[model samples]
Target: MSRFDENKFRAVTWVQRHIANPLTRRLPFQTVLETTGRKSGLPRRTPVGGRRIGREFWLVSEYGEKSQYVRNIQADPRVRVRIMGKWHTGTAHLVPEDDARARLKSLPRLNSAAVRAVGTNLLTVRVDLTD
Candidate 1:
């Protein structure tokens, strides 16, 4: 990564970890993705933006593999998603072949705009809900 990219990464990470994550996780309307920690073996919840259709939830990760939650999903696909205060179990899939920018257009607007603006390694993810 270039120096600029690295710097942006740090900035975004800091904002998400310290400010965004704490507040968003507490919001009842915020969608949260829960994955088992790859190293610590504990649940890790990340505030995400997505919409559920039938038995699937679609989202685009702004940082793709670099995102901590995405990394956890890589280690363990089995996950849980909290949508509108309800928890649902699912399996996450990283869709590298999909068009992330286009996928974002189909998702919630506010998040899609943020992701498009700050995201450098965009990638698509799909969660297949089990129940």
Candidate 2:
């Protein structure tokens, strides 16, 4: 990565980790993705913006594999997603072949816009809900 991109990534992640995520995860109506920590053997919940379509929940990771939640999903696809105040179990899949920018068009607009603006290596993730 170039210096600029690396710097941006650091800045964005810092803010998300220390500020945005901590606050959002507490919101009752906020959508949350829960993944088992790859190394810690604990649940890590992240506030995410996505919509559930039938049995699948689709989202784009702005930082791709570099994101901690993505790495956790790589370690274990089993996950839990909270949608509209209800939790559902699922298996997460990282779809590298999908057109992430196009996929974003189908997601919530405000998030898509933020992802488009801040994302450098966008990646699509689909969670197939089991229940």
Candidate 3:
């Protein structure tokens, strides 16, 4: 089987569709965030795991460094997110080394941390939206 089998995928889908709600947005921590490429000028949207910090938000992707989304965010922090029938536009920033490390620790999933360990090699963009 792949990293996550069909059953796991189905369960994840069910959770993303029904179990996760506004009241418990935290339950479904991952989302499909959209952004534009800086150089290519191509439209791109990818599902990634993100976390909200006080007012700002951060997304940690496995392909943070070479990913076009990462490059696009670096070139321009402006971004939009669609979740729970709401659209948001905001400014994004690259998380400093210290902050990135701390964030990796807070993650309950070891897999997430392992992925984040490559964070320095990748790009971690922090998006801040009014909504």
Scored by TM-score, the top model is 2
26-88: candidate 2 lDDT, tens digit per residue: 999999999999999999999998889999999999999999999999999999999999999
List, residue by residue over 1-131, the lDDT tens digit for candidate 1. Answer: 68888899899999999999999999998999999999999999999998898999999988889999999999999999999999999999999999999999899999999999889999999999999
Model 2 C-alpha lDDT versus the unseen true structure: 0.97
| Top-lDDT structure, candidate number | 2
What lDDT does each candidate get?
0.94, 0.97, 0.59
User: What would the C-alpha RMSD of candidate 2 be, to one decimal place?
Assistant: 0.5
TM-score of 1: 0.98
Alpha-carbon shift of residue 28 in model 3 (angstroms): 9.8
- TM-score against native, each model: 0.98, 0.98, 0.60
Ranking by lDDT: 2, 1, 3
lDDT of 1 at 65: 97
Model 2 residue runs over 4 Å out of place are none
What does candidate 3's lDDT look like per residue over 1-131, in tens digits?
Answer: 34444455455445544654333434344365667877677766655566666666666655445555677777877788765435677887776463555565554466366555433344456788877
Off by over 4 Å in 3: 1-30, 108-123
Backbone clashes in candidate 3 total 3
